[model samples]
Target: MKALFVAGTGTDLGKTHVACALLAAARSRGLTVEAFKPVVSGFDPHAPDDSDPARLARALGRPEAWAEVSPRRYRAPLAPNLAARLEGDTLRMDDLVADCRDWLSTRDVELALIEGAGGVMSPMTDEATNLDLMAALGLPVLLVAGSYLGTASHLLTALEVVRARGLTIAAIVVSENLDAPDLDQTLALLRAFEQQAPILSAPRAATWDADALVDTLLA
Candidate 1:
C-alpha cells in the first residue's frame, strides 16, 4: 500500500481532520484506503475513548474496529515516549513500524494515511522524534497548517524544515481552525507561496464537507 503521512506545524492543527477527509475522499472515489494514527498519547483515564484513534474511527465510520487500526495508545497528556514511560510502557520504534506493516497487510489499500502526533519534531520516543519515524517510513508527506493570522510563516517554516530533512511533500493543506470566518488573507498567502504541490483550504471542523475534501485530495 502507498502510505501518506499527514503531519502538521503543531498540535491541534486539524491533522486528524484532514486525514479523515483524505480517507473518506479516497474511499468515496472507490479507492481502498485506511487511516492509521500510530502511537497516540494524551488519554484521559476517566474518559478512555477520547483518543486520536478513537476519534478517527468515528470520523471514518469504522467505530467497531478502532483497536485494529491503532494499537499503541497511552494515557498522560504528553508526548508518547514520556506518556508511555509514565504508564510503565516503553515506546519502541521497531514495534510501531511492525504494527503499521501488519495493519496495512490486511487490506490492499491504495493509500494509507498515517497521521503523526504533534509537530514533526515532537518526540515519540526518547531516541527519535515523529519526523524521524516519518522519514523511516519513506512516505511522501502532506503538511497540514492551521489557517490563522500567522499561517504563512508557519507554512513556510514547516516546508523549509521538511525540505531540509529531505522529506518528499505530496501537498500542503491549510486548515481553518478556531472560529474564524475570514480566510481571504490566509488563502492569498498560500497562493502566493506558489509551492509545487497544491494548497487546499479546510473550513471549520463542523462545516467541513467531507465529499469536497475527498475530491480535492484524490483529484
Candidate 2:
C-alpha cells in the first residue's frame, strides 16, 4: 500500500504526466499499480479523451470511466469548489477523505498514486483545500512544477508551504515548458533547493525511461 500524492504548483503543471510515467514504470516491473483523482473539474465522463481520469485509467490499463478513477467531477473548468457550486453540489472535506480511505482500503497494489486537482492550495471544498487532503492522507508528496519564468518562485513557495505543514516530499519533478527558458537555466534556478529533496527534470516531447524515474522515486 505504498502511495504518493501527485500535487502540482499550479494547474496543468504536468502532474498527470508524471503520475502516468510512474504508473507505467511500476507496471513494467510487474507491480500492480492504481491511480485515483478523487475530485476533478472540467471533466466530461462521456468524453474521456480530454480528462485527467481517463489519462490515468489508460495508464493503469483500466476502462476510461470517470467514476472509476475520479469519484467526483464537475463540467466547469474551474476550481473544484467553484465547479461543484456551479453544478449545485457541495463537497465536504470529511466525505472527500472518507472516499479516499475507502478506495485505498480496497486496493492491494504495490503503488497507488492519488492526484490532486489544480494546485496544492486549490480549494477542494468550501472549507478545505488540496493540502488538507494531503495531510489527511498522510502520504508522501510528489510535487510537480513547470519550468516557466516564474516557476522558481512558485516552486519555492510551494516547498515552504509543504514544509510548514510537515509533509514528506518524495521528490520534485520539473516538467519542461516550451514557453520557458532553456532547461539548463530552469534546472539552475531550482538547484537552490537540491538539498531539500531529489530534483528531477522531465523533457518535453522526448522519449523518457519511466523506470528510471520510478527508481529515483523508490530510492
Candidate 3:
C-alpha cells in the first residue's frame, strides 16, 4: 500500500485537514483512497460528523466508514493513552500495527493516509508514543505544523525527533493559523532551516487546492 502517516507538531495542528486535502487530491487524480485515524480522542458518538475520522471518511467518499476508520475512540478530550485508560483499556503497539496492516490489505486501497493523534511525542499508550508507532509502521511521514508565533521552535523540535528516529519525512505542511495567518513567514522560516525535502503550506482559503502537494507525493 502507498501509505503516508500524517503526524502533527501538536494537537489541532491541522493533520486531518492536510490528510483530507491529500485524499481529495489523490481522488481527483482517479486514485482509490482510504484513511485511518485508528485512535481518536474527544469523540462524541452521537455527533460523529465533526470528528477527524468523519472528515477523513467524507473526504474518501465513505462517510459510513467513520467508525471503522477510528476504532479506538474515547469521549474525553485527552491524549489517546489517557482516554483509553478512562475506559479501562490499553493501547498496544502490536495491535495498532496489526490493525493497520489489516486495513491496508483489506482493499485495493491505492493511497492510504494514516493520521496520528496529537503530536509525535504524544502518548498513544503507556509504553508507546506516536513516534514509536511511526517507526513501527515504517511509512513516510507528512508532518503538520502551525503558523503561529513560536511555531518555529515547536516545528523544528518535532522535525529533529522524527529525523532522529530515522523516519523519512515526505513533507512538512505549515498549516495556516486562522488567529494569526502568518503562513508566508512560516514557510520562509521553515525553508531557511529545512534545505531538503518538500515544505508546503496549508493556507486557510475556501478554494484551497492540494494539487501541488499531491504532485510531490506521487513523484
47-72 per-residue lDDT for model 3 (tens digits): 99998889999899888989988988
**Top TM-score: which candidate number?**
3
Candidate 1: the clashing residue pairs are: 25-214
What are the lDDT figures for the candidates, one per model?
A: 0.77, 0.87, 0.88
TM-score of 3: 0.96
Q: Model 2: clashing residue pairs?
A: none
The number of clashing residue pairs in each candidate reads: 1, 0, 0
- Superposed by TM-score, candidate 2 places the C-alpha of residue 82 at a distance from the truth, in angstroms, of 1.1
Model 1 lDDT per residue over 126-190, tens place: 89888888877767898898877777777888788787888888878888867654676777767
* Cα misplacement distance, residue 107 of candidate 2 (Å): 1.4
Candidate 2, 47: how far from true, in Å?
1.4
Model 2 regions lying over 4 Å from their true place: none
Candidate 2: how large is its RMSD?
Answer: 1.4
Best by lDDT: 3
Question: What is candidate 2's lDDT per residue for 142-209, written digit by digit as tens?
Answer: 99999989998899999888878989999899998887899888887798655778888887664565
